[model samples]
Target: MSAPRLRVAPSPTGDPHVGTAYMSLFNLGFVRRHGGAFVLRIEDTDRARFRADSEQQIYDTLRWLGLTWDEGPDVGGPYAPYRQSERLATYRPFVDRLLADGHAYHCWCSPERLAQMRERQRADKQPTGYDRLCLGKSEAERRALGGFADTPVVRMLIPDDVPLTFTDVIRGEVSAPRPDDQVILKADGFPTYHLAVVVDDHLMQITHVVRGEEWISSTPKHLLLYRWLGLPAPAFAHMPLLRNADKSKISKRKNPAARLTWFVEQGYLPEALLNFLGLLGYSQPDGSEIFDFAQFSADFEWSRVNTVGPVFDLDKLDWLNGHYIRELDLAEFAGRLTAFAGDPAHADVIAAAAPLVQERVATLREGLDMIGFLLVDEASFAVDEAAAAKHLGEAGQEVIAAAVLALQADGEWAHEAIEAALRGALVDGLGLKPRQAFGPVR
Candidate 1:
């Protein structure tokens, strides 16, 4: 068999979503396993909602996770113009051909008329869709209708008697009733997602269409377009959507876990984040969760993917991150924490304190809090009131005073020497136990 070509098409509308990374992980894993080509296509057709800076954020975030693509807008490939906005001319020709062949018609219905149509449908308890009022109108008649704009939008014709059926790699054989005639091209002359995606996927030679299960309803619409255009459809695999603890679909507006940048900013290791996402709807054959990205790519299989939605548990992610944090060597761990610290003034202190708190922190951001006392000015440093109240009473002050005297006399300031001095002053010199003596000074 020939090598497959898979692509992840993300819309640059807002903050890069965790769902985008989830889909990319699976697509990249599949491509790596088969030695196939992975592509990144920017679906920036929604001009009204698009943000200019969002495109670069998507690229940066994906690369941070080490999910590199073979072809993208940044690096030109066999298929140049990876962005949909750049390929506008390519879609117009296909739309014109469909119109000329009678497979689609111009829709001249005004906004008011369409709104009233939906209102009437709601009142009559009928399915809400375009009534196809202008489906049979001619060119001259459409031009005579001065109530609307200069030109009409294009809509694909859906056969009422034809039942649509397609087998999904994850959902198995699925069937749906014939859908209403969908608008393929908007009034603004921009093709809708249904038309644009079908055209671009065929042109890009994408062998598989892997996306979230939310797109399953629109699969039939896409299938009809492939048939109308006389183009072979690619294989479809709709993965389960990520859910919150409450079982609601994950949304960036409501859930922080939905944003990819949230994890990065929170100091989550890229390897750990990717490993956690990989196990959401898929698992290893050995049922281990502490594997690296390369191991995941080697063991990834479509048959092992679960169809049920997976919950985005924050606590579970923290546990996974803690495991990865502990596995790093001392030098590498100190380097990662130092980068997160973002302060050269504390370089010597951070290198000294990192090994002391390596096992106590799950994230590098958490390390900042754990060692805050060592970095702050003496005037700014303050002990926790509750902890001081519990351990630093009048009697506790004497133990700390003795610890200070012992440390001042120590010849060496090394870790072992400091440790031995504290132990002699607190545990041996004083009759009090180690916990009791250290509690006051700690």
Candidate 2:
């Protein structure tokens, strides 16, 4: 078989989501192991929502996590202009052909009429979609009417009551035939994901389509598109959804989406985050926690990938990060810290946190956390103001001042000295135990 070509196409809008990383890692792994090529494509067809630097950010975020693709919009390939916006001219002909062949039709009904029909249908327990207002019109008739007046959208003809079956690498024998004939091209002259993805994947030689379970229900529409276009369909592999601790799919507000920036800011090693994502739905035979891309690529098996969703457990990630951190030598850790410390805004934070973070910090990856306190530039910390108020009562304040002063007297500034002085302040000044003094500060 030819090397399995796979593409990871993400819509650029906001922060780089972990879903993008998860799918990209899988694609990169599959292609690398099989000597196939990995392609990066940006689906920025939504002009209004398209961000200026978002495509660049996708590249930056993925590369930060050590995930790289062979061909991309930035890095040109045989199939140049990987951005879908640049490919609209390519999709226009296909849309016209589908319309002429009766495989698709122009929908002229306004949204209000369409919504009223859908509401009535929903009120009567029926599927609500386009009522095919202009499906019967011939090409000449549509042209005579000033081309449907609204720039015309192309929708596939989804026949009723026919089952569509496609094999999933993880879940075999899956079928969802006769899905609602979804729109292939919008009136804005941009191809919908359904059309753009199908056409690009075929043109780019994508052999496998590995994505989250969320797209499983929509596979029929894609499969139907392949059949209608008479093109070979890529093998499908729906990696299970990632869940939070409560068994719900991971979300940004509820849980950190394991974004690349989040991992970088948290001081997590790229290798560690890569390993964590690698093991999420796929793991080694002996349950090894840390694996490099080479080891993972050597062992990758699509068949063993889990169908049951996995949880994005922060505690587990912390443990994994700490493990990678400990594996680093003191010099390497300090180098990483220095890189972040070089940031002028974060410099003071690391300076203040230097004594506190010495051996206690699990990852230099957390340089942002060390400097997070400085963001409040008030005479004191604000967000963590409650931190001071919660523990630093009037008497506690006296002990802290005394301790800071006690250490100030000695020119040798060290954590051991500061800690010893603080301990003395707790016992001699506040008459509190060492734990009691530090407990409130924490």
Per-candidate TM vs. native? 0.88, 0.86
Residue pairs with clashing backbones, model 2: 163-177, 164-177, 266-365, 266-366, 267-365, 267-366
**lDDT string, candidate 2, 1-442, tens digits:** 7899898998887677888999998888878888989999999988877888777878888998889988999889999889999888998877787777778877765556666778899999987666665778866565564424556677888877445777898899886635666888887888899999989999887889988898887898888778777899999989999988889888766665555577766667788888888888788877887888888888788877988999887778777777876777655665567575556555545555555554566666464465565545677655456766777888667666766666667655776777777777666677887766775554
Candidate 2: count the clashes. Answer: 6
Give the RMSD in angstroms, all C-alphas superposed, for model 2.
3.9
| Deviating ranges (above 4 Å) for candidate 1 | 138-151, 377-442
Task: Report the number of the highest-TM-score candidate.
Answer: 1
What C-alpha lDDT do the candidate models reach, one value each?
Answer: 0.89, 0.77
Question: Model 2 reaches what TM-score against the true structure?
Answer: 0.86
* Model 1 per-residue lDDT tens digits across residues 80-183: 89999999899999999999999899988777778888999999999998887787888678657644556688998887755577899877898765578889
Error of 2 at 233 (Å): 1.6
What lDDT score is found at residue 76 in candidate 1? Answer: 86
* lDDT winner: 1
